[model samples]
Target: MTTLLTPDELEAALRTIGAERYHNLHPFHKALHGGRLTRGQIQAWALNRYYYQASIPAKDATLLARLPTPELRREWRRRLIDHDGTEPGTGGVARWLKLTEGLGLDTAYVQSLDGLLPGTRFAVDAYVHFVRDKSVLEAIASSLTELFSPTIISERVSGMLRNYSFITEETLAYFAPRLTQAPQDSAFALAYVKEHARTVEQQQAVINALKFKCGVLWSMLDELDYAYVAPGHIPPGSFRPQDDR
Candidate 1:
């Protein structure tokens, strides 16, 4: 925007962006949650998503290093801990592996990222690079998507549980913590952006940062839908869901 917005107005604008651009609105997400996706499609989703989950601590650590104060650093540190946990076999990333294993994917294969779609790698890497390279304001702004995540988590957990027999609550445990974590994380980010992004240029940059993150997420799903949902476009060497049989 060319004009300076009040904090509430800026928050409204950010929420408006979420309402319009969040990946929860993506067609692939719709199918996945609505039970329209096949086992293979779901496997591909879980497999590709592992890359994003695994990279989150790296993303948070980049931004955490840039924070100016102990408070900010401590706040962001919780994110690192959240994803990495105090030790192995704990944290969000490990929980995500459990999810992939629940989908019958081998833990080593998911960790190796051997079958990751190029699109997944590109989009997720772009997100990390964005955090590493951008202004701290923009970096913080990108995380505003967390504001909208809880609702989608609710939809996803409920829908998947009801529709898919293979997907039990235990399999989806990763999301349980995220329902609370996302709101807390986004509340901090939302306040930070509203307070820090005071000028027109800064405000617009924040808006654009959120839009960029949304695009990153949306693009990942787009690749999944194109490669898996739309028929035979799975890229060469990407995971081929039980083709051995």
Candidate 2:
């Protein structure tokens, strides 16, 4: 028989899942933060990651659109604003471009996503589907990855700065705001899960939701590592770094 845990216990289990499975611990990230990747590898990482960043506001909006309450919609709209920005050539996507541009990739190619990995597309699209198809609680729980993002962001920023002469503070501007925003967003989502997940079943669902999301992120990196680093198989019609050969 399966064991049911208290809300506090479930929260601890979720945190443990993150500690164990989150992408921060992935070898690719270790290579990235440890300055082991080449410029081409870094560029490949950024280009592939753009898809994830671009999809965030849309996923958030999809969840917001399903929200029945004006208060919830109003709260979620800020995430859209944060990613979409108030004007042209701003916000997270644009800032991500800055990183790509700093790395010498053409903005058009990166934005056009001409070189995206098949696995990257599949994993991110699954996230969108999860938000659309799942309950509001599960949708919100999927974003609990944000709870662990700040740590990765901090390591990436500091390590990249020290390691890559081509990288600049401006290139990393996207992560700066997220440092504060992620915690604020995750705290609310966590508290909501704890409060609303009154039943053992609901609580278990929330835990599963988080684990599923962690898998989503992990799968993305695994794709990148396989396609770009290990097997080095650049799939047909995907972006190929100049030095890939």
Candidate 3:
């Protein structure tokens, strides 16, 4: 059987999970931000990550649909607009495409999502389902990964700019908004979890939810590393390195 923890203890446990399991610690991330990746590796990173970026609005909408009150729904609706945009050529998804375009990936094929690794789709989809099926508290808790996102974003933007001549600030602008948005969203999520998780069981569930989310993010990178880096197994029909082309 599991025991409930006090709110402060719960917070500490969540931090511990971030310290140990966050994608920032993954070797693929280290290679990415450390400038060790080839151009093909960078492309693989962006292509896989598009799956994660594209799914955010759908998952946010699912949570919004589940909210009981108009106020919460209104607050959550901003996330959808932020990702999907008020119009074309705007918002997070479009900005992400800019990153892909800058990387020389064809916008049509990228948007088609026909180029994604199988594991990338599976992991990102699992995150959306987690948000939909869990308690509201746990759903909100899962987003706390954003609490840890700003640092990784910083590392990615700075590292790419310094190491890769092909990368430009405009290409990386997708992260600029995320730097602000993630902290704002995470603050709300963290506070929500801290306040609503009154019992130990609820608090533990929130902690577990964050851990599960970290695994989701981490697993995507693992898949990328395995398929793009180690043996460089380019899955059938997926993007292949120029040398392989």
Candidate 4:
């Protein structure tokens, strides 16, 4: 039987998962931050990533409904508010549209998700389903990816601003609030996982949940890289960087 890990040990294990498998290590991100992609490639990225951003609240809502306590529900609901906002034309999703618009993508087109890559849709949907169906412990642990996000967000904001003149601070405003929000969210998730995952089976499940979440993120980039970078096999009907109309 697997041994149970101490809370500190489990936290360390989760961090190690982020270090090794997170999308920050993806070549697409390296190319993005290195300013190696064309404006159209960046446009495709913003357009595709918008789907992930837009789905966050729905995913959180699924988990929110499953929380057994008022405190847990209250804490989880903060994510919905952060992403969906107090009203429309605000919050993280709105800020993401601002990015797409700044990238010259039509807001309606991006929101319509008309040309989103098949892989992007599948990967993101899997996340929503995971939260909805997994044990609440696994569901919360999946969000532990946010623990590593602040660093990547900082890297992306600085790198994009410095390398891509077309990208302004306003264009990347989506990440600014996330700098604070992600840490707060991840801290809560990590603590919850550490507190609740007391047995060997539960601890391993928590670790696997983090790994699964990382795969979701990494696969999204894998599709982007395949379609836009090497081999350049963009699936039919998907947004084409060359067609930037």
Cα error, residue 210 of model 3, in Å, equals 0.8
Candidate 3 on 35-123: residue-level lDDT in tens?
88888889888988998998999999999989888877877888888899899889999999999888888989888989899989999
Clashes of 4: 0
Of 2 and 3, which scores higher on TM-score?
Answer: 2
User: C-alpha displacement of 56 in model 3, angstroms?
Assistant: 0.4
lDDT of 1 at 170: 94
Per-residue lDDT tens digits for candidate 4, residues 75-178, read 99999999988987899999999999999888888989998999999999999999999999999999999999999999999999998879999999899999
lDDT of each: 0.93, 0.87, 0.87, 0.93
lDDT per residue, candidate 2, 81-149, as tens digits? 889999998788788888889888999888887899989899999999999999999998888998899
Give the candidate order by descending TM-score.
1, 4, 2, 3
Q: Which stretches of candidate 4 lie over 4 Å from their true place?
A: 243-245
RMSD of each: 1.4, 1.6, 1.7, 1.4
Query: What is the lDDT for 173 in model 4?
Result: 89
TM-score, prediction 2 = 0.96
Question: Can you tell me which runs of candidate 3 are displaced by over 4 Å?
Answer: 1-4, 243-245
